[model samples]
Target: MLINKAHQALTDDVVKENFLKYGNPDGPSDVKHGIALPKFLIDGPSSPFLVVIYILMIAVILPIFVNSWWDGVKSYTKLGLHVDTTTYFLEYLLNYNPAELITIEKIIGFLSHAKEFKLYKRSLTPEIVQKLLLSHINRTQLSPSEEQLKLQVVAIAPKLIIGFLDLAATFRNNEVCFQLVETHRCLIQALNPEANATVNKYKEILQLPGASLEKLDTTQPIYTLGKLLKKPTIDPSKFLNIENTKEVLDVAAQIPLIEPLDCKFTVPGESYVPPASTSHVDLRFIVKSPAQKSKPDVSKLSKEVIETQLKDPETLDYLRNPLKVVEDQPKMPLYSVPPYFPDVDYVRQHSGWVAFLILQKDGGKLADVPNYITRVDLSNLKLSPAEFLESKAIVSAYKFPLSTPTPNVGTYHFRFVLRHLLYFGSDLDIPFVMNIENKPVETKRDLYEIEDPDEDSIAGAFAQMRGESVKKFEHEYESSDDEDADDDEEEEESDWSDIDTDTEDESDEKK
Candidate 1:
């Protein structure tokens, strides 16, 4: 038997291949091998034991793994927030009364419920954070630790809102998203602890670098950035120190203000929208840099420049195309970034505006999801003060497609909200009307131009064939019968007169 096995191993093709590749004859041993099984476990009597092992894996172990994965999925929201965190926000916002004013303290206290605060790994808990925020809101003094916690939570609030904005946008929840954006701006304003009460009340003026409550709360009520810029003979030196005035002016010059040129809701390439027709909102506006303390005047632009830039076919095509491509402008300077936030990366400023269409009749409810305007050209900010004011305007257009048709023929009142992401007072609200017209009535002419059918004509013959009659023929038949009756009466009278004359002649002859 040993001699036969040796011959078979030497002659086998598999053994030869293994010897050539791995230099082994017993068909190459695995590099890593499991322990050998016991004789009883590998025997026929172990079949039942093997079946039990498989049942345990399938029924218990597999289900345990599946349940763990499912639990993980249920724990987080689509916004990557903990389920409890989302529930906390929703419940708080639901009970919130709209009539009540939204103050910085109220919003900060509300934001303390976020679960991310626990991740700080400090002694701070959600309840402790809430109590500290409440004390801050009530104007109570806090210890150093409590103060640090308050600032940290306030800093985290805006970052948390940025995440919630993404979640709201993912679901296309416009109203909630807009409210979140406004809340973000409020939180940013709250970061400045040195701002006075007046500054807190009118937070919009804070967008300017050197503006403060003392300079802004003067006789003239300049609460907004636009108002501050538009103030006649705006002297930065009056508000800012002489050394800092130039820096403030340069920063102010870069702030953008949108001036609406035309806003209309209509069907493209058509004069009017018929009932149940598809339509879209067309918004035309110019992005003007308020460098000269006033709105950019389009009239300042020469006639030739307007005709070439605004009225040219290529420029018109660029404006009308849904995908607008314009020359890029210099990015926002680093010095312009807000300094109160803990980390610039978390609260990086974006140069864009979110456009929202709201229906006035529905209590100013959102009519469509928001759109972003990020392609605006800010090259004018780089120009000298004089050239910047008189330069050609940076015209941008946005088209919002309505999902549903206007089934009714009437006027609709809508408000366009142009909300700036970084600035508070730079937002614009424009109210416009959309008119849906009725379809035109068609005037149909006779196909054959047949005259009023005569009773004796082929047209009349066809009418009779179709079991129809003309009113004119009926009136003519009645008139002919009346004439015949009158003629017969006259003839009868003449015959009677002749008979009377003949009888008289006979009587005379007899006499």
Candidate 2:
């Protein structure tokens, strides 16, 4: 019910605010008209919980000890994504902000009175959705789940487009209704959980397709009001017209309703198409640098090395768990690496403290470490012997199956993990995890269009690297041509056999 109510609350006031803040909130003051639906969802301040969440976000959560729930505000602040709902929820839990400048009444009223904001849901018109999504693809920051969602919606768009075609039959001003119908794709994509893809795809299409929902057919005169609601900015009073707004609402209701489309293809963000949700152990090994290394001695560890490893139960259990090493092959599956570390650090100076995280089956206590260890030295370069690496806690991670079928497994998926801990003065928690999956994917990517001399230089490097004779190239070329001609002759023979009775007689005679 709240979702429906919330859906109803997409009004002009909110729509105006959304575009102003999100799309271009600070643009020229004169062009105060466009779609008001998005703004209502964003800036109209309707979500009491969400707004309180936002204020609390600015107030309390900044001081919380957690680092990676919604991802810290530090890096996100750069990306400017905190304006959305994910971070807003996290703020509510960490920092309970009590004092409110804006009363709940005012907030809810703003949303209630705000003219209906548009939600480009996946209606029957999927083509409209695809055009919109592709158009905005360049601007949105969709998670891995989101990319899959984009593809799914694209595949499903045709079905949705046909749905709108049925709705298009009801309106008198077919142009206005049809125009809006045409843009069903963009609106549905905007509703997509893959916000980033929607935005980016939208930008792409805006350059070319230039299609919008303004083309669809509709059952009501809501198009004229839709124009008013689409404004980038509008006065609250302008949309607060209860009589006209209700009339528009009636019309919107009469038309074929558009509801939020759940992506069955996969979750929006990272496309984790697991084989069977079958549990498998994932082990990451980190080589710990000693507090002190005397010199490079392959035979023995340095005296400065803290021989006493973290003998904590969690740590011991992790190493004790038998790791089954998968057979390494030439082909590597595409894996996504979470942004474990912010890119704003002096990486060279970072310490070589790594973590070998183990995710157990059944999902509890995935991270064995404690919240805080005197391991500040383990995180930072400064080691006073007291701030040694301790048993600090790890955040929750995807757990593995309780019992694996395979034997003592080591890492088969990952070749190696090159990670460095990020030390913000005394903070040693943030770790950067970069992996060389198996080997480089592209060996000869930019071979074509290279100048002859450059090509020769590359060829020479290849020759020196592989120690191959220069004539090897010619031999392979000639051999390949001979093979092709022979293959052609063989194909001709096969073709003769496929012919009718004459061919059958020839085959019988040959036999």
Candidate 3:
């Protein structure tokens, strides 16, 4: 085969020219090579009948015949229980390259010569065959049935590493060969699922805990070369951060451990009484709870009563849980001087404690309006215990409709109420002014960290705005690529100079 290739290459001037110019005959030479037409076709006189028949048979008749067989075989094969092996075999043979026929003589000659070198005895043993099949199975793309066959082949095959061990034994007391065999054994156990499972089971039977094939360092040279021919054993723990005891304890310390307690309302502070019509009157105050040494267990306690009371102020609870209203309040009256426009937009803009809607009142004393109270509606809110604990309990919207009254405009007062979340807690009173005009309320929203001016101060703002253009600080590196390239060029120049000097000396000696 080698001799034939060399002879053909030597005969071809194009290949030689391309190699001299580009150092690569295959590189963009634009030379096309092909088998020439038969000598008879080119040299002999043409026959019209034979030509017509040959063209017709190959281009039309052959395709039609093949297509008919293909269609029939394909349709029948879809049943899966039966298939035409002859049709598939015919297809395979027909599709094979015609160039293969040219290699037959060379292959026959090579095989005849190979026996003189004792190459016939170099057949693969069962162990080596098993390894090759398993490696092929791990790397090749196979159909479901083909994969099943490969797996079955792997199952029936004998242990492959045993063959390597036997080969190693022949080299008696050779440390390198034994080491290589051991490496192969480790890699085989890592790549082969059946082998790995068997190893694990054996380890378990021997009480060898934590002996896992997955933990093998597959990146090492011995394992990496083996993995190229088989499936890789990737250690997932390499990507995971394995925390130490101290680090874990430090992380746990950051979490809040306080148990929450129901709180009592204190006096609310305000900058302005009856704040701007648009602004919500945020009645803020700190609540006090009984100081207990530990949180009371509410799981076994009755809903009707407090299990115990704190007699000492020093033993009062410190953790304050946010207060929530338990139920819905009846619609209240709205008396306004500007003829309270019973419009949805107006009502929505003016409403406070959004979970409850304000309704128009028919008859009520002006004094009773301020003190009117009912259970706050909490039906709209849906929250899990963890989320409720983490986040604030505030409803931002109420979808109730605001009905237009018969009267166009009049002085109105909507009685608003406040209720405690706990059954034992009392109703709280809040002060407000009546008969206000509708105004566009600027909604208050807490700024996200990214939007905060303090976070994006001048220095931070400049850093972010520059993006990738900003030069990043990197640790200094030794011997960059430019230095390496320069060194390589110098080495090549030196080598050429040495060669030139040797040639000149040789010429002088010849003279």
Q: Give the alpha-carbon lDDT of every model.
A: 0.63, 0.30, 0.32
Instruction: Give the candidates in order of TM-score, highest first.
Output: 1, 2, 3
Query: Which stretches of candidate 3 lie above 4 Å from their native place?
Result: 1-51, 54-76, 79-131, 136-191, 196-511
The best-first sequence of candidates by lDDT reads 1, 3, 2
CA lDDT, candidate 2, residue 484: 79
lDDT of 3: 0.32
Per-model TM-score versus the true fold: 0.59, 0.16, 0.15
Q: What is the per-residue lDDT of model 3 for residues 1-511, given as tens digits with 9 covering 90 to 100?
A: 7566455556778866665677655445567974255757745677555567778988999999999898767644322212332243223334544345322122112212221112213453434333435453233346776555444433222122223223323332123222322233222222222334443333211111122244433343222211211222443234111334233222222211122232221111312222232222223221111111223343433433232221111221311211121212333222111111113333222222211223335332222211112222332123333333332222221111122221222344443333221111112333333333333456577665233333235654676675523334343578788988998999999999999999999999999
Tens digit per residue, CA lDDT, model 2, 1-511: 6555344445456645655566632333554654324556666557666667777876778756465554555433332222232243223323423254322222122222211111223342434433435533323445676554554443333233233322332222222222223233233223221333332333221211222323322222222322323331343123333334444333222211011111111111212323222233232211122221122222232333322221112344343442212121111111111111122122222222222222232321112221111112112122222332232211111112323222222332211111122111111222222221222244464858443332245675676577653432233344677787997999898777667668788889999
- Each prediction's RMSD over C-alphas, in Å, is 22.8, 35.3, 38.7
Q: Between 1 and 3, whose TM-score is larger? A: 1
lDDT of 1: 0.63
Lowest summed-lDDT stretch of 10 residues in model 1? Answer: 322-331
Which of 1 and 3 is ahead in lDDT? 1
What total of clashing residue pairs does each candidate reach?
0, 92, 22
